[model samples]
Target: MSHYPVHTMATAPEASQPSLHALQSAFGFIPNIAGAMATSPVLSSSLVGLFGNVHGGSFTEPQIQVLLLTNAVTNEAEWAVAFHTTLALQQGLTPADVDAIRSARLPNDPAFAALSRLARTLIEKRGRLDVTDSAAFLQAGFTEEDLLEVIAVTAASTITNYTANVTKPPLEPAFRDHAWHPA
Candidate 1:
């Protein structure tokens, strides 16, 4: 982390500035994840681009949060787990569901359970989802489009998850209340 050079908008490379500033505006601060990510402008920009694509995809905000939280927990990314925990609640997920995901359990709700299971499987299987995995997601009422969108969300989360692990960014204060550790 000392070697990673956590950057501010002012200190970040020009390629990274827009992404950093956007994250700052979205969360009202540049998360340490983005700061450390700024150390490599190309990678940072790639994350921002992937983020935009995922957010613009077919999933609703709540679904997106579910995917993110699932990825965070699956990957054991403490920083992302904390950040996505807050976001998941804000997106109208119940505390119980969030807790279930945080604890590495499936949510009680059927659809969300399907989503969490699908996301976890996608990651655990390294995106080589078998037909049964996709079938289960479809059985839960998700569309083929939704299935593809899940891949986008997974990719986006993978960027954040990997970046946080590598940079070991300290959690931002606002998200610390929901801080998590992989069980």
Candidate 2:
């Protein structure tokens, strides 16, 4: 069993409540993972801040979801896989594309394929991308700026992915249909 407490707004430390509130406002409820993360004020706050920046950054919401889902799959974080899978579909990613990401394959769309490949490569290689690795992304029509933004999105998902692995938060019902297991 996980030692971490899945905090709620009322149960979280005072410093963490605001972050939880922000999550609530954004998602209509605080995710169980974020609730567990609330045990640490710093982590919860940092996640919320970085989340805003990443979601508001260069990529569209669907693109961001692609990176997040890819990262979760690569990291083998089950909770994150389910969470991101739900968000990716809600953001209008095709069912085939979502299935492709879950299966460790690229999507059909060129830009999404580039994003999934780059995210998986980033995690699998632990951020060590060579010229060829980056050239492929650029060749797929993403700019250098967009490439860096992928790092930012990856960073954001890494926080959640790692946290979910450690905290082992129970998946909420809303994401139940999309639940994933690492193969």
Candidate 3:
């Protein structure tokens, strides 16, 4: 296979020194995806900001992981699925929680599980959330705002997953142990 190009801030016009250095400082090395995104600093920065907002949203880390893993699974984006699964684990999601979300089953929390199902459905169906699904989400104790946040999380992951696939960014060493394998 042809190797994907390694993007450097020096070579990618859209990158600035501070942004590049910030990434280097955070990760101890700039991620390949961040490097490729150097081709469009605006895109990279916006994505970072958006995801930060989503991460800061009311949903717990494992809840976010359920949505991400569901999307990645539906999209057949193995890399994203693996990476986010690892993220869930790192954030203290139980093995059962991981398996539940990965299998598209809701754990004991029917409402959240329903929310997970709804996220996967919206992704698979391209934004056509059913009325009952909306009701289910509401019943699950998520507000309209949380639903919007769910969409945001899904959209954010879609962007990164596609970027990583297209750029073939090298998986960070920390993530390599969890490198993708198709389910």
Candidate 4:
């Protein structure tokens, strides 16, 4: 069950938008976390924009998915983990791939593993990257520009994960099977 009551898109249409309705129609239900976002259309749109900026910018889909899952695990945010894991798999990642990313390992590709490690480190260390860290990532084929963009993406998702936790957004029925209440 949700920690708080999530206003559905119907009665609380003011809390949502036409896009939100489209989301509901497309996915069969608006995710409770996303529904909580409906309370502030500006926030919802900004969140969507941030997602688009990060997910659609710089990184490949698999890499972005892994980074999202990594952030959730590092923050111990269950909902973020559940939501992104579902989305990644739906986008064609295997269970093993998800597991690898969650563990900060990438069995299939070393470059991705390097990226995931660097991302997790950046998150855990809170932006104080060491010279050695930078060197290792460089050897792994990442440029300074790539690192900067990755930092931006990481920062954006971190905000969303923390916000969702604070709001205790309802986990959609579609995600019930994967919903986790982090202790």
Candidate 5:
């Protein structure tokens, strides 16, 4: 069992309530990871703000999901893996592509393949991307701006991925069908 409480809006600390409510409004429910993060008002609120910026940035929702799912897999965060798996499919990523990401392979679509590879490389290399690392993404048709946005997406997922790893929150029902384990 998780030591961290999966706080609801009512049960969360005062500073965390707004962040919880924002998350609830965005997702139509507060994710268990977010609930756990609420235990730290700073974390919960920081995530809420960064979440907005990341989602509102240049990438499409499906593209964002691709990066998030990749990061979750690389981080080996079970809750985030399941959560992003569900979101990835809902955002129209094919099962084959999602499976590829979950299996630590690139997707069939070149753009998504670029995203997955970049995210995995970023995590594996700890943000130390050499020229060849960056050239591959640029070769895939993504701009320098998209590369930076990928970093933003990675940053957001890191918060959730690390939080989920630490909190060990229960997977929600909606995401349960996509449950994952590190290979």
Candidate 6:
């Protein structure tokens, strides 16, 4: 059983309502992970603020999904894996790219593969990137700022990953088709 209560917008704390509503607006529903996070107004609002910054960062929408999906996969966060798989395809990633991420492999596209590699490395190394690691990401055409932004997106995904692990939210039906498990 889930340790956390999955709050609806109506039942969620007042301070968490806007964040829940924004997630609902963006995704057409309040994800269970967010609902559980809503149990803490601070955690919910902080996630929303961090997500806004991550989305505002220096990458394209599809590229951002690459980073997010990679982090989710690396962290073995099943909920986020399903969610980001859908988002990546919706954002115009090739089906193959999503499949690669679903399989915990680099995306087939060279640029996105580079992104996936860097994201996985960040999590695996706990942000202690070797110089060669950062250089390879830059050599793949991402800027220095983009590397920091990768860290931003990683932070955002890590929150969801940790939340899902703790709360054990059920995956939404809409994302069921894309559900994943880390190999």
Candidates' lDDT values, in order? Answer: 0.90, 0.94, 0.72, 0.72, 0.94, 0.90
What TM-score does candidate 5 reach?
A: 0.99
lDDT tens per residue, model 1, 99-176 = 999998998888899999999999999889999999999999999988888888998899999988888888888899
Candidate 3's residue-wise lDDT over 1-183, tens digit each? 315555676665644445666667755776677676666677677667776777788888778877887777667665676677787788776778777776666655565576678788888779988888788888877799988888898888787777767776666677776666555
Candidate 6 local lDDT, residue 66: 92
Relative to the true structure, candidate 1 reaches a TM of 0.95
For all candidates, the clash counts are 0, 0, 0, 0, 0, 0
The order of the candidates by lDDT, greatest first, is 5, 2, 6, 1, 3, 4
Off by over 4 Å in 5: none
Scanning candidate 1 in windows of ten residues, the lowest lDDT window is 1-10
List candidate 1 stretches off by more than 4 Å.
none
Question: Could you give me the TM-score of model 3 versus the true structure?
Answer: 0.81
> Which candidate, 1 or 5, has the higher TM-score?
5
User: Model 4 shows how many backbone clashes?
Assistant: 0
Per-residue error at 10 for model 2, in Å? 0.5
Q: Local error of candidate 3 at 114, Å?
A: 3.0
Show where candidate 3 strays beyond 4 Å: 8-29, 107-112
Judging by TM-score, tell me the better candidate of 2 and 6: 2
Higher-scoring candidate on TM-score, 2 or 3:
2
Please give the ranking of all candidate structures by TM-score, highest first, separated by commas. 5, 2, 6, 1, 3, 4
lDDT computed for candidate 3: 0.72
Worst 10 residues of 4 by lDDT: 1-10
Cα lDDT of candidate 6 equals 0.90
lDDT per residue, candidate 5, 1-183, as tens digits? Answer: 889999998899999999999999999999999999999999998999889999999999999999999999999999999999998999999999999999999999999999999999999999999999999999999999999888888888999999999999999998889999997
